[model samples]
Target: MFEYQLGIDFAKTLDKNDPLALYRNQFHIPKDDTGNDLIYLCGNSLGLQPKTTKQYVNQELEDWATLGVEGHTEARHPWLPYHEFLTESMAKVVGAKPIEVVVMNTLTANLHFMMVSFYQPTPQRYKILIEADAFPSDKYAVESQLRHHGYDDKEAVILWKARKGEELLRYEDLEQILENHGHEIALIMIGGVNYYTGQYFNLKQITNLGHKYGCKVGFDCAHGAGNVALNLHDSGADFAVWCTYKYLNSGPGSLAGAFVHERHAHSKTLNRFTGWWSHNKQTRFKMRDAFDQLPGAEGWQLSNPPILSMAAIRASLDMFNQVGIEKLIEKSKMLTGYFEFLINALKNEHIKIITPKNQEERGCQLSIQVKTADRSLHEKLTNAGIICDWREPDVIRCAPAPLYNTYQDVYNMVEKLKNILNE
Candidate 1:
C-alpha cells in the first residue's frame, strides 16, 4: 500500500522524487485570470494540449500550401499513407499488433463499423449486450444497430447492470446473465473502462466468457486507450475502438482508432464498409482494377484522413512512445492512490467516491458522488479554478492524469475541496 501523508510538503516531496514529474512541462496547463495554473484534473473529458501540437500541425499546413495535391505523395509526412505513421505507436499504446490497429473515424462511427462485421445476428441469436450505464453514444450506436438488424431494441439489448444499492458491477452477475441468455446474444460490446464509475473491466476475462458462449466480443476503449494497458490483442476481443482526444493529448474531436485482432487481419470474408483507402495500396492508383482489400484493420478506412488532426495525434503519441505506457500506468496507480487517501481523510459525510476502491479496477478518475444531488458542488469546484467535470444528477469526476498532473496538484485539489465542503 502507498503510505500517503496529509501535507503540502509531503505532496511536494512525492513530486520531487517522481520520475515522470518532468513530463508535466510537456503539456499546456490552463491558467486562471490571476495567472496561476488551474488544477486541471479532467483528462478523462479531454487531455490538455501538448506543447508541440502547434508545430506538428503547422508542418502539415505548410506542406498543403506549398505542394497542393502533391502533398498526398510527396509531403514530409505523405498524406496518402499518413495514418500508417500512427499505427505502430497507437498499437503499442493499446497492446495491439500493427496490422490489427488503424487510426480512423470518430469513436461512435468506428463502433458502428465494427458492429457491421462483428455483430452479425441470426433468427436465434440477435441480442447485443452492454453496460447499463454505458456512455450515451455507445448505447445509441448499439440500439440503432439492433433496429437496423430488424430487432426490437428494448428486447434485443441486454444490459449488465450493477446490483441494486451498489455502485460497481459484479463479474458473477455477468456470468449468470451469459449462462441464461448467451445463446441468444450475437455480440458482447462493453466499455473497456466504464466512463462514469471509472471501473476498468477485465477485458480478457470478458472476452473469454463471451466467446465460450459462441458470441463475438468487442470493447469501446475510449477511456482506456492511453490511460491503461488495454492489451486488446491478448484479450482476444474481435475488435475495439477508442478516441485520441482523452488521455492522448490529441486536439478536440481528433480522429479515433480501431483495432481488429490479428486473428481477423486477413479475413476478407468479413462484411464491412470499405472505400478506395481500403483497396490494396499497390493497386490503389489503378482505379479500374478489381477491389483487392487491404489485409488487416487498414481495410476499414473509408477515406483519406485530415492531416492536421493526425499531426496533433502524432505529436502526442511521440511523447507516449518516449515515456512508455508501463511507466504511465505505474505512476497512475500511485498518483490516484494518493488522491484517494486525501479524499478519504476528509471524513466528509456529504461526499462518497463511487469508483472502485481497488487500484486495478480503475484509472485515475474518481467519481465523487455528491450526496446532495446538485450541481452546486461542481460549480464550487469550477469557481475554485479546479477544472474537473460534473456528470448529470450527482457525480463530480476528477481525473488526475499522470502524464501531466502532479502530486502537488492532487494535494491542492483535495485541500480546496475540503475548504469548499467546510463552507
Candidate 2:
C-alpha cells in the first residue's frame, strides 16, 4: 500500500515523477465543447483511440488501392499471414505462448467457437456453472449452449451467486458449488474479472479447482486482457477469449484474441468448426487438398480475417509490446490506488467503492456504489466533462488505464465528483 497524500500538488508531483506519464500523449483524449481535454476514465468500456491507429489502418487501404488482389500476398504486412503478426505480442499481453494465441472473430463468437470444442456435455455431466452476475453476453451464450444441447436452459445452468448482502463472490462458495454439483457440471466458464465489482479471480486457483472436479475451465477475459497479467499458459485453463478495443486501445469492435492451452494444441480429435484458413498453411492454397487442420489456436479459425481490423490491432499491440504488461501494471496499481485514496478521502456517506481493496485482486477499474443515487449522478459527472460508465442499478465504473491515464486525471475527476455531490 502507498502512503497517498491529499490535494492537487500531490497529484501533480506524482504525475511529474511518473515514468509512463508521457505515454498519455500518444492517445487522443476526448474534449469538451470548450476544447479542453476531458478526464476520460471509461477505458473499461471503450478505450480512447491511439493516435497511430489511423496510420495503421491507412496502410492497408493504400495496399488495397495499389495492389488490388495481390495485396493478400504483397501488402506491407501481407494479408494472408496478417493475423500471424499479432500472435507474439498478443500472447505476451495475455501471458501465453504464440502457439496458444490467435487474433480472430469477435469476443462472443470466439467464446462460442471455444465452447464448441471444450463444452462437450454428456447426459451425466451436462450442466454449466458461471458467476451469477456474469456479463449478460456470457450468461446468454452459456444459456443458449445449454438449450442447444437439448437441456432445459433454466435447469442446466447453475449460478454461483454471492451470499446475501454481498457484492463480491467468495471462492469458498464456488468450492461449495463444485462439491455439491461438480459431477453434473461439464464446464466452468467465468469472467476473469467480475465486470460489475471489478474483482479479479485467481485463474490458476479456479482452473485447478475445476479440474479436480473433472470440469473444463475457461475464462472470458474481456475485462482482464491488457488490464492484468493473466498468465494464461501457466494458469492451466482450457481456453480464454478477449476483445482488443478496451485497454488495448484498438478501434471499437476490432478483432478479438483467443487462447487454447498448449496441451490441446496438437489434439486431432478436438471438435471445432474450421474452414480453409484452418487447413495446413503449406497446402491451404493448393485448392484441391483435403482439410488438414493446422495445429494450436490457429486451427480454430473459420475464415480469413479482416485486414483493416487486424491492422488497428497491430497498432495497439505494438504499443503494448513496447511498454510491457508488467510496467503498465506497476503504474496501474499506483494510479488506481491514488484514485481510491482520493475518493475515500472525500468521506462521502452517499458512496462507497465496491472494487477489491487488494491491488492484486483487481485491475485499474474501481466500481463506486452510490447510495440511492440514480443515472442522474452519472449524467452530472458527464456534464462536468468527466467520462466514466454507469452500470445498471447503482455503480459507476471508472478505470484509470495506466497507459493513457495520469495521476492528474484521477485527481481532477474526484475533485469534480466532490463538487457535484456537494451541489
Candidate 3:
C-alpha cells in the first residue's frame, strides 16, 4: 500500500501514489460514443493497446516496404528469428526458460500442438482430464485430439467438475477424481485460471496429483499467463499454452505462447508436427536432409510466423520486463483487493461475487452474479461508460488490470453497479 499523508480521498491519493499509474498513459484507453473515457474494466477479455505497439508494427511495415524479401534476414527485427527475440521476456512473464518458451500460432493451435506431444493416448491410459468449465476452444481442441487418436470423447475425456451449487473448484474434488479415474487418464490439461469464475487454481498441486496417478500434466494458461504467477517450469507441467491478445495487451487474434518442460527437451521419440520452422535454426536454411526438430518449445512451431503480430507482443513483453511481473502482481492484488472491498461495502444482495474470496485463488477480475441475472444490467453498465463482460446465463466480469487500472476506476464501477441495482 502507498504509505503517504492523505485525507479521506483514498482514490485521488491512491492514484497519485500508485507506482504503475504512469502505465495508464502508455495505453490508448477507450472513449464512449459521448467522448468520455470508458471505465475499460475488460482487460481480461482484451487489453488496451500501448502507444508503442503502433511504432513497433510500423517498423515492420517500413522494413517490408523497403527491404522486401530481404526483410527476413536484413530487417531491424529479422523476420527469420523474430520469435526468438520475444522468448526471453515471454519466458520471464510466465516463469519459463527461454528454450521452454516460443511465440507461435494462435491459442487453440498451440494447444493442439502441445497436445500432440504431451497427450499421447495409450490403450491402458487413454483419457484426457479437464475442468468442466474450460473455455470452449480448449474443449474443442482436446475433443478433436481424442477423435484424432481414434477414441470417442465420451469415453476418453474426463471432466473434473465443480460440485452442485458451487461457484469455484475444490482441490479435494480434483484429487478425488484423480484417485478414482486416474488410471484411465493419459493426461490432465487444466486452466491455470478459470476463464469464467476467475479462479486461479493451484498449478503445483494439480501437476503433482496427475504425476502421482502416472498421467502427463499440462495447463492452458490463457487467463493466467499475464494475470497470475504461472511458474510453468516450476509447476512441472508437461506443456502449456496461452494467448497474447488478452492481458498481454497484444492486438486481437494475435500470436500465442507455448512452453515445454525442460526434462522433455531432448526426447527424440516425442511426436510433433514438423515444418521448416521447427527444424534446427542452424540448418533450416539448408532445406534438405533428415528432419531435425529443435529442442524444447521451438520444436513445436509449424511455420514462419506473422512478424507484425509478433512485434506487438514484443512491445508489450518489453513493457512487462521493465515493470516486472512480481511488481505487477503485487499491484494487481492491491487494485483487485480495493475493488473487492468497495463492492463488498455495497452489501447489496442483488450483486454477488462468484469468484473465489481468497486472493490466492484469484487474479484481477471479479465475476459478478446479479440476483436479477438479466442482460440489461450489462447494458446499463455499458451505457454508464463501464466496460465489463457478461457471460451466458448470468455473470458480469470486470478486471482492474494492474498495469493501467486504478482505485478510482474501481470506485467508479462500483458506484455504477449500485445505481444500476437501485433501478
Best by lDDT: 2
Candidate 2 ranges with C-alpha deviation above 4 Å: none
| C-alpha TM-scores of all predictions | 0.99, 0.99, 0.97
Ordered by TM-score, highest first, the candidates read 2, 1, 3
Clashes of each: 0, 0, 0
Q: After superposition, how far is residue 78 of candidate 1 from its true place, in Å?
A: 1.1
Each candidate: what lDDT?
0.94, 0.95, 0.89
C-alpha root-mean-square deviation, candidate 2: 0.7
Q: List the residue pairs that clash in candidate 3.
A: none
For residue 109, model 3's alpha carbon misses the true position, in angstroms, by 0.5
Cα error, residue 221 of model 2, in Å, equals 0.1
Clashes of 1: 0
lDDT tens string, model 2, 1-423?
A: 479999899999999999988889999989988899999999999998989999999999999999999999999989999999999999999999999999999999999999999999998999999999999999999999998899999999999899998898999999999999999999999999999999999999999999999999999999999999899999999999999889898888988999999999999998899899899999998989878989999999989999999999998899999989999999999999999999999999998999999999999999999888899999999999999999989899999999999899999999999998899
Q: What tens digits encode model 1's per-residue C-alpha lDDT throughout 1-423? A: 668888899999999999999899988999999999999999999999999999999999999999999999999999999998999999999999999999998999999999999999999999999999999999999999999988999999999999999989999999999999999999999999999999999999999999999999999999999998999999999999999999998988999999999889899799999899899999999999999999889999988898999999999999999999999999999999999999999998988999999888998999998787588888998999999999988999999999999999989999998898888
Order by lDDT, highest first: 2, 1, 3
